[model samples]
Target: MEPGTVRPGGRTARVRAAVLEAAGDVLAEQGFAHLDLAEVARRAEVGKTTLYRRWGTVTALVTDLLEDMAEQSVPRTETGALLGDLTANARLVRRTLTDARQGPLFKAVIAAATCDERTAAALRRFYEVRIEEWEPCARQAVERGEIPAGTDTREVIRAVSAPLYYRFLLDGGLLDDEAAVRAAGAACAAAKAGAFTTDTARPRSSDR
Candidate 1:
């Protein structure tokens, strides 16, 4: 089955998941430069021909891997307050970024994406989906007057994770629950202060 053609439901989904899991393991073990499609096939116990036929290039494989990661990412939950929702988002992001396997895999994928357009596009799509997933929490906050109207939801979501990523990727700092709480609190304060609010704000429905 093609990398992007597997329908979610039965044996095909399971096979695809197995392949992605195997690929992720390889990626984490040895960076993208060392990723071997044949090794992935062997580890997944799938046909090498299938892997080749589906993901023809390293970029394609990484792209599909990123898509799979995004698909497996946790969805946002409504916890009745903006801080709670953001705290959930922050903790989830922190956990993923600090995870032993996922952290290395993500670093490899991000490095590959920087040089490969297909990988870059896939990375963008992955972030887009995540941002959209969290946008509703920001919108709900606006509806409840917990945040300023016309706040940029996507930016707010990005802010919540930016510091965590920065520390993990750049400073090599520990990503703990305290860091998650700090991130959420900072993002919440920024949102309330209109840091994420739009300059070209139009009247919100609640204002009408």
Candidate 2:
């Protein structure tokens, strides 16, 4: 377990939950620049000493918070078809990015990662976990012959969410249902067209 992370059980669970909640709230509302440890402790009603002992620093607290978020994240949707599954995944990403609290929270974290190495690493790990959870959908598609063999499942999953993230982080476009559908459709089309086929699907070095 990382620093500031603990097995949640009974009182320890409650304390961890409160602390992380406070930290997330702070990040969403005030951004990372204002996420003071003392403030988080006060908001959580946890002792300053306890916060210091457990989290040690704001970066560690944020890291643990992200880990907790990933653990608590919703499981992948199974829709039996590649397009259906990708649509579900895209919609989930859209909802999260447009959520009342989660949107700003993610934006703040992304901004923090731009300048903080530890925060950036934690953010990357968070996405990696999410992508792994969703990658199986593409693999299943291959088995169903909906996509070609050697399709890069990870890339397919990433592509589904990439447009949504770009709009959320750069274009500031609305993440509406139509946008979600469009993103999923485009990725599915590309995958079917062999856009994400791995190099293994091509001729081997010896064959060339």
Candidate 3:
């Protein structure tokens, strides 16, 4: 390599990593409303000018953070069986939502997305990536004749995580491991019953 080649994961990468970590800590502890760039710089031990020059705005930084999170997210587990696969997925989601840092960080991003269009788009993309990663589980189930032929695999994947999100975001219900199993079981049952079949899916507003 040439001199000052900035080898893989060198200063630039380290700075970005530190900054993003600091940002996540701020979001998890204080929420989006309090995510100040200067504070983030201070926490990361990076210069404020570097943060401004790199990210420019809070929304941009947040969007990048979300993208990084999606990229770094754990890969889906393959269990051959639909229920088993979904249960693994559900457990993963539960673990993330119940984690000390990740839990609050997700809540902060979700809250920000509710009112910020850019954040909402980023959040949607994040879930899209996650769903795509897990969609194969449902597809494999179809190949195994575990679900109907025309089943909407995406819906099956979404179903497995929806209840867990509801508990995490709205219901205040117990978000235990059993809850994850139950969520997976319910989605699996629905899939096996053809509830998520394309033919049974609700029509779009334009179709109506």
Top model number, TM-score: 2
Off by over 4 Å in 2: 203-208
Model 2's alpha-carbon lDDT is 0.93
lDDT at position 20, candidate 3: 89
Clashing pairs in 2: none
Q: Please give the CA lDDT of all the candidate structures.
A: 0.87, 0.93, 0.91
Supply candidate 1's per-residue lDDT for 48.
90
Give me the runs in candidate 3 sitting further than 4 Å from their true place.
Answer: 1-9, 200-208
Tens-place lDDT per residue, model 3, 1-208, is 2111222377988988898899999999999999999999999999999888788889888888888899899999998899999999999999999999999999999999999998899899999999999999999999999998889999999999999999999999989999999999999999998889885564556877
Question: For model 3, how many clashes?
Answer: 0
- Provide the TM-score for each candidate, comma-separated: 0.91, 0.95, 0.91
Question: Which residue runs does candidate 1 get wrong by more than 4 Å?
Answer: 1-9, 202-208
Candidate 2 — worst ten consecutive residues by lDDT sum? 199-208
Candidate 1 vs candidate 2: which has greater lDDT?
2
The TM-score measured for candidate 2 stands at 0.95
Write candidate 1's Cα lDDT for 68-181 as tens digits: 788788989899999999999999998898789999988988888778788789989988989899989999999999987889988898999999988987887888999999
